[model samples]
Target chain A: MGLVANAGDSRAAVVDRPGAVAVAAVLGYLVLDLVVKLSGISVFFLGMQVLGGSLELGSLLSMVIDGLLVGLAVGLAGIGLSMTYSILDFANFAHGDTVTAGAFLGWVAAYIAAGLGTGAPIAELFMLNSGRQLSTVSTFVPVLLGLVVAGVGSVGVTLLVDRLTYRPMRAAGNISLLIASIGVALAMRYLIAFVFGTQTSGVASGGLRITFFGTVSMTDNEVTLLVVSLLLMLAVHLLLQRTKLGKAMRAMADNEDLARVTGIPTERVIRLTWILGGGLAGVGGYLLVLESGTISFNFGWILLLLIFAAVIVGGIGSIYGAMAGGVLIGLVDSLALIWLPSGLTRAAAFLVLIVVLLLRPSGIFGGVTTA
Target chain B: MSQRATVSAEVTLPDPSERLLAIRNLDAGYGDLQVLSDVHMDVADEEYVVIVGPNGAGKSTVMKSVFGLTTYMGGEVVFDGTDISERNPDEIIYEGISYVPQTGNVFGSLSVRENLEMGAYILDEVPEDRIEDVYERFPILRERSEQDAGTLSGGQQQMLAMGRALMLDPDLLLLDEPSAGLAPDLVEDMFDRIDRINDDGTAILMVEQNAKEALRRCDRGYVLVQGQNRYEDDGSVLLNDEQVRQDFLGG
Candidate 1:
């Protein structure tokens, strides 16, 4: 809170003339810093490499790719969070658990589908203990089936949760709803732990790797994540732009009172919002597991903060902003390894978030609402 | 036209069969705080009625009460013979009435056509012809159909808000302060458009802060002071009455 006050105070002081000058100076310094570091040129008087001896070209490229891979997942997950915040007007803490729920439900379905008639008991398959190696190439059908189940199952979970919790508290203030969501989040996280056990386990195998033009290389899972995320993102874009329900959602977000006066069924819109947000969170979680080749009971719970950082950075209520913010935070988190240790990368991503808030306040698309 | 200079105490209401909207001794307010009392008024079929008064006169509240936005403390709001005093806004909309609020009337983030599309959301399908009709009435909106409503000028936004309300083609249209923030030049243009809409057979129940101009144009005018009806008369009679001039029109 004090940090926010100080940032706001400094912004007020630099309100008119010197603000532009200060911004330009800071931008100029950063550009120079980037040029010096990327070229690997050492400023001799300072000793040591300029910015820790310019990174190896291949390593830097790989770090960027890794950042994008993580960022895409974060962005995909953040979309649901952003949509709910815009329309429902609350930060749903249970969203992270919804992601976890999607992964568990999806993986179980995938296992059951893949191991059918393979002499494995249904109980073992349900427990995902068939001991079969799953990959994009080896079990393509199962992986695809898992993605669908993740989305659909998550939608069901969110709708049920909304009916049980949020729907009843619909008339409450934002702060009260927010607190209720925290309680929901805790219950969901532990319920998943109890059901799936608390251990992290390997869930996928490296199926294939494609080297593009003898230079860039990517795993088959990474390719799958990229393609699926892009397609889903595109689908969301079309839905918002081309569909009636999508327009009604945006209109309701813009003005709920006017929407009601115009005869829009606001309750129905709210239900659809949960469905969309929950489905996206679930699909994103499954994709994250597919790319990383592992799954844990609380992976989504832990990833929630990073997803939040991405959403806040992008502009909390804007879907496109969440995507852009996710990629930025992802790149920064991975690229921070060039200067800071891997353990501090999360802190670096938060630092970027703070800087963005200080500068733009409303975020990249602030005041623009949910477009 | 024969009922000229009728004071609030002896105001004569139209026959129930001829009335499109009839509010009888309606009392309403927001959540426990009453703002209106015994407010009786009527808008017959295709009639243009305006309610004008000073700040806090509950002029807007009366419009809100008619549309089921305010708390129904007592009395009844009958529209085309349906008792909608306790109905919700969604239910009231289906009763052939549409309301445009004084502020935040248009969906700022939505495109022009999208805003119009949302106005017709109660219908299962988008009425493309209604969109065409709204566009015809306000050609500027058609030119900027793809643009966000937020980017429009104040006058254009007012037109869009009215256009959105017109999407349902309701028999009674409630407009709350249509010329509230418009430029002096554009105010007359807005009033002219309202005249054409009324001419095309949509009865208008409007509340306006510009009392004199509203009285000058509407077929009938009601002067509401402190939430109660003070005077009800033909527009010109209210415009010329000495008592109304002194108390409201600034003699």
Candidate 2:
């Protein structure tokens, strides 16, 4: 009884744990030291890597700019994945392929528009098999048309997929739906490979580059991607926050049965969910290839893991969280190149995801299903 | 004008014998588990009906079956001369029936205004006058129109749920446990608001746990036990019935 009384509060043992204290001390010390170094006047450390390394104010700002551009693309792609998870109550493994579908569809349309009757065979143009530079400069009209076709084509593909596959198996539960999505993903990947072939090809032709600050030039490709992605994201935000359809989406996410009972037309809402999710995913794919200058059948499948990482870290079902999480993932993936090998940067970002999930299992914006 | 006439001409006034909602020999359940058996009930035009019973007596299931939310095994649900027994909820909405579930009736993440907007989803445009009437009916909601429904107090959320259902100005409104989580003082206010809605000519079919209070306000009442009808009488008659008072109302 005396020993029991001497135990103090129930948390006494945990508080006295030496390992926890050491980790906390190290993390705290690192943060404080970094803060001191950034102040630049302190000069507390002997080495340059500890004090500054190659990260100058100019370079850091440039790095932030670079990170943000790619981050916006990641965020834009993550929105559709987040929407599907929240509204449909399942993770669509095929979403990445949907992005690829949009990108390829848009590219084909661009190729046909630019190369039609200009000494290039229609077959080669449609297949995108030839080595052609279809850039913003050489194919402005076709590129803009491609963007439109990207949005339209993906919408068509998604709606068809929903009608053929998802709609029928909706009541089969999330696990079955998830497994079904994996099948869809494989089918889509191989189909694209079948059509476009397994070869990696360059799509966009490079245009002008404008220097922003010294040595930090904004390529036309980056600017175009940035502007288009940001505008779409803004449109999505406005649609969700200020429109009737958006509210219905949110309501369905909250409770499908209540939504139906309240005359919200739950089935119609589900259809709309697929439409928007598929549409955004298509645009995301189109933008990814436009920015990266390369297109492959499996590019989207490869990028799916990173996009999923962003969605999970941002809070699985939250659109805004997806965007923020995407940017954070992008930045981490970019900035990790400073400390680790370029090949290991993706691994670092994923490790960060594991750590964050350990600390906040619900994620940065979880528990709020405002789709 | 011709198109409008053509659209409106299809509908005619219903016969007087046809009640707003008529449930006969309803057998419903979730999956294979039968929760209600041979449930029979009726609500006339503008009539207020209340179903009261003990826990797991399938009081809510009866309401759910009427709304086509439960699996129908047998019998039929006839609403406004239409055998809506086989109809789904989306089709039933066009029949002018709105149901508010006990829990999760309102979208917690959506703002009060957005939740209300979602209620009028079938309409092409926002009905401003109806929104104003709803605001007048519950002024507290107007004050917190932009606030998230989740952030509201229990009483406010209950009001918002009722308001959302009322957005359609439904012919028949199904309410399950309207006063379940309310503050003691707010229960009467909720009842009074329901009375106002009923007075405005909207038929109400409610399932409540508070038998005595529910009986006091409703026009007619049904006592259900073990998924079967125990008694059916005028609210005052059941309140006064010695058997009902001792068994269900705990007098």
Candidate 3:
């Protein structure tokens, strides 16, 4: 009994100690410094290197830009995922596949429009591999039109999925819904593979490079990705903060039963939630492929793991947390290439996620609900 | 319970034409699990009715069934003369009734004002006058209008929940256990607020755990047991009844 008492008292003391937190922070900083040292850049402090100087200045800037591009897409996509989780009460496994569907269809639309009158086989153009050079700069109208189609297409698909699968099981437990989502995920993935084929293919080409901060230069597609991501994020923010539907969504997320009795049209709000989430997922998918100039049947599936890490790190069910977490994960993963193997950057992102969780289990945004 | 046979519970029953809500032979539950049997109850326009009983007596179930939250196994729930028995909550909102659950009654993440805005979500525009009225009713909520509902004290949250329900200015309000988690001193204050709302002409159908106070305050009182109505009468009659006083009011 005395031993238990001593341990509990010390445990409380340790938890309350500010110095322990400081030590953890310092250790994290030192580890980051060590990782930076493993890279090639050079910097010195007191005749020894203890800070960043691993990559070329231009290379560093370019990586930052790349990270931001990836981050914005992930953040935008994660918003829909987070909203559904908060309101619908489950992690939608099909969300990643929803991304894939949007990208594949958006590319198909763009290819058909751009390759029209080029004498390419209509079959190849329709399948999105006619090789007709489809960069945003050269084919602005088709690309822009494709982006809109992506958003609308995903909403239609998501609503259909909800009506068919999730809606009937609304009264079911979260685990049951989660399992259903996993089934939805596998089916959607296989369906996309069946249509688009398994081979990874290139889409956009020859981007127009523009200067950033007088040091780093960004391609036209990158600029498009950044602008579109920023605008979408802003729009989502405005809709959630200023609109009645957004408040209803938040209210439902907070307490579905209470929302019901409070005269909120809960089913209608649920529909709105899917539309917003599905549209964002679709737009995010399109922007991601545009930024990388590459598309594959299962690319979105693979990207889901990293996106989960970001959402978990930021705090699941928090819209702002998902966005902020996406940026953080993207920055860390991209920047870690200095100290980590290119392939191991994803691992490093997960490690950061684990560390964040160890410190705050509810996540940085968990308690904040849908806000 | 031995005095159950001698109880005179029909005193001061309202006329059918004057009632705001009428539940006839209500048999409802969650999913396929029935929690309420054939139960008949009514709330007249501008009347204050309180249902009090022991825990798990299906008091809250009655409120849930009235709001169309639970599964309607059978029976009818007509509100303000509309047959709303099979209507879902989305359709029920148009019937001009509001419910406040015991827990999670407020949208924790939304601000007090936002919570009120959400109450009128079915409306095209936010009713500024209704919001102002809520603020006037709960002045502390007015001071904390920008604060998140989750951050509020239990009593404040209760006030905000009631205020949100009042945003629609409904003909009837179904409040479940409004004083459940309140501090002891604040319980009477919460009751005062409900009285004021009733005094303003909104018929209130409330379920409460504090039987004595609920009976003392309301115009009518109901005692339910195991999903069935046990007693129904004027509040004072129930308060003075020997069986009710001993079995429910903890004599």
- The lDDT per prediction is 0.88, 0.84, 0.84
Which numbered prediction scores highest in DockQ against the true structure?
1
Candidate 3, B17-50: lDDT as tens digits: 5568888778999888998998878898899999
What would the per-residue lDDT of candidate 1 be over residues B34-126, giving only the tens digit for each residue? 999998899999999999888899999999998889989999788898888899999998989999999999999899999999889999999
Question: What would the TM-score be for candidate 2 when compared with the true structure?
Answer: 0.89
TM-score of candidate 1 restricted to chain B?
A: 0.96
Residue-level error in angstroms, candidate 3, position A290 = 1.4
lDDT of 3 at A133: 58
Off by over 4 Å in 2: A1-51, A127-129, B1-18
**Per-prediction interface RMSD in Å:** 1.2, 1.6, 1.6
Residue-level error in angstroms, candidate 3, position B148: 1.2
Measured on C-alpha atoms, candidate 2 has an lDDT of: 0.84
> Model 2, range A229-286, lDDT digits (tens) per residue?
8999899889887877777887888777778877777777788888887888888888
Stretches of model 1 off by over 4 angstroms after superposition: A1-41, A129-133, B1-12
Docking class of 2: medium
Looking at candidate 1, what is the lDDT of residue B80?
A: 91
Write down the worst ten-residue block by lDDT for model 1 chain B. B1-10
Worst 10 residues of 3 chain A by lDDT: A1-10
TM-score of chain B of each: 0.96, 0.92, 0.93
Residue B53 in candidate 1 has what lDDT? 82
